[model samples]
Target: MPAASITIIFSPYHVGLRNHRVGDGPNRIRALGLIPQLEALGVTVHIDEIPPVDDFEGEIGRSFEVLRRTSLAVSKARDGNSFPFILSGNCMASVGAACGLGIKDLNFIYFDAHDDMDTPSTNENGYFDAMGLSMLAGKSWHWHTEQIPGYAPMNYKDRFLYVGLRDVNETQRKTVAEAGADVIWGDAGKAVDFPGELEKRLDKRDMSPSLVHLDLDVLDKSVGMVNGFESEGGLQEEDVMRCMSLLPKKATPVSFTMCSFNPNLGDGDKIAGIGIRAAVAFVEALIATSVVSVQQ
Candidate 1:
């Protein structure tokens, strides 16, 4: 089989919050030598950095602008037949990833500690990052998303699976239930069969290309809190790896995004190291799955 090739797109703008250091996540990951590690695995890696947009309007404006740029970069990578591995500061980047793939019908697997299902009316903190999944499901933010070229809201709510969610409020939970989206609560131990459960869910849905969205906060604080919003009783490194390994078998992963790694909030080196290892494991797993699929 041919060697697995991947394009790494870095988005360094954390426009979700004002005056936050989450924007520095991509640089820190690069500085820690993620590319060399992937190369060591015998994978062809291409790096594309998305320039930060300087929007004078506000956080929301800046967020949309960054998503647009990321969408374009991801689209180009897909057009070239390179698997896009997006390393972004905010989870909202998922919008761009979905748009770039240009799939009208796709499954979404979101791994995060928080539900990220808040709408403008439901969000008390007024944080844009908190409403990423909501926007992706076409639950809100229609006016802003219309401005982004090639952006289409995903109306198929039942096609999404929310994993490792433990930080959700009553409002978010109600919204998620209303959307009929599946949820797998976070487990500190190996009590849940993550891969098997996920496979079962996918089997029930239509076979379509899927996208995996990983928020570093899905990991337990002990493993390394990559962002400020760290919740307890999260998945361990092995659990995360196992779940990611099983993802491709259930559905074709057209693209993936790893987001919400704020190096300034915790031990920068430690958090970055953990993130690098996780990212490498995910890519390696994808390659292995691809090879197996081809052989079959």
Candidate 2:
């Protein structure tokens, strides 16, 4: 393995949610000087911004368009052997990340407070963001998935590993169980061995490329809420770092996404700082993995 490089894809649109401030997340993260911090780690960094589309009507349509563009950008980064790190407003961008990687047998690691597995019929809030994982698994929004340039819906029934899930609904929980997806439940004040559990699962399965999706809402409120959908029982910052540290060794992390960080809802700078710390941890893990691979 050679030196690791990163391609940062900024997606500022928030069509998945009907909220006003969510769309501002990407810009806020960039404004907080994340680029310079990443560069200081001794890796080449490329920043690509997805231009906003004005013609798409409705939340679903707009989300489709934005993710389509995200797919293209991620694909380019993958082709160059540079890690794709998507900074986006909503979790649905994970679908685009999967499409861009073009790996049929990829394992998905989703870290979020919510399950994001609701289908159109089961979703009562009418939030497109809620159905992100469902769409990725080809359970809902078939029309939108087909429109994404290089996206092919994956049968991720048993390939998903969910962490920090504490705010999920009954329907979503049932769906996850029925699909046989692995989960590490979030406890209100207790810390679980997240990295150890994840490593066990990875070792049981056949080695495959992975996509790590981090939704900032998965962090406990004590860490600072980056979005409106804050949950009480969640993972601590150290737990997240631990899981990320194990990711590159347990699985080949081809792409990563840090989403749902809405800076406008809370102390903006503070929230952005927390997000930056998590991003740095992820990069450090990748760099460490690359070095080990070279030695091996």
Candidate 3:
């Protein structure tokens, strides 16, 4: 009943957060609830860890390695009949999965409260987790900037889209502008009606596959629960759903990531359960779209 075996990898690595909390945050978050719902929806959960951190190049190297491993795991998951697989991870783990998927000239539909666009040297601290996007774009340390070879790195070019970003640094703005990418602010008041919007927007830019990464913080801290570094001027759950509704028909193997769920949303069980349900709905919607295409 578990969708013929889906690899639900829980990345326990917390290589990014400057402020630390529970040592078993990953396990605790998982236990709060997700397994039962996913199983009931016909999904098998395969929990596992990535290769240990390396010391030579510090955390960044380990981070890159994990991305590559995630890619490998994803590839294996996709073998034979392609069932919708799920991956739950932290910040840098998201980076690894992006690398794992060979997205050339990729368009990133990044939904988060922050830009995650800070270059390493530019960051006040030498934290790889904080600078995942910058390094992916080949914009950071010469060594760490390398993405999986031949894979399209996460450049801010025509390939980037930021939704629900109400807080950011100046460097991120300049970088985003340099790439001429589009950024959508998540104001609760403004309605997102821009004239057949998404199509008009995508039609105006490059035509390629996309990587959609949704950081849990995009939702108001009240609705989704337990996010990393909560911010003001947040997006409502409906707004987030509206954004998800715009996923196109032709985007190949669309990759979606739900990241940095801090497990602090009030009534942990309800919060985590609903969060998992929302995530699963997104995936289920993706598969249903495939069915719609077949019938049409």
State the lDDT at 106 in candidate 3: 59
lDDT of 3 by residue, 68-167 (tens): 6666665555452233233444565556566665556656777778777677566764544667776666666546435454345565666676777766
**Clash totals for all models, in order?**
0, 0, 4
TM-score for predicted model 1 compared with the true structure: 0.89
Q: Quick one: ranking by TM-score, best first?
A: 2, 1, 3
Residue 262's lDDT within candidate 3 is 54
Best by lDDT: 2
CA lDDT of each candidate?
0.77, 0.80, 0.56
List model 1 lDDT by residue over 1-296, tens digit each.
32246889888778744325777887788899999998777777888887656644778788888777778888888777678889888888888888878888878888888888888889988768998777777778888887666777776467778878878788878887887778887765546655566677777875457788988888877777578788776777777777777777667778889888888876777777777887777777777776322112
TM-score of each candidate? 0.89, 0.92, 0.77
- Lowest lDDT block of 10, candidate 1: 287-296
lDDT of 2 by residue, 147-215 (tens): 887777786656888888888778878988987778888877777677777788888885457788999
Full-model lDDT, candidate 1: 0.77
Candidate with the greatest TM-score versus the true structure:
2
Structure candidate 1, residue pairs in collision = none
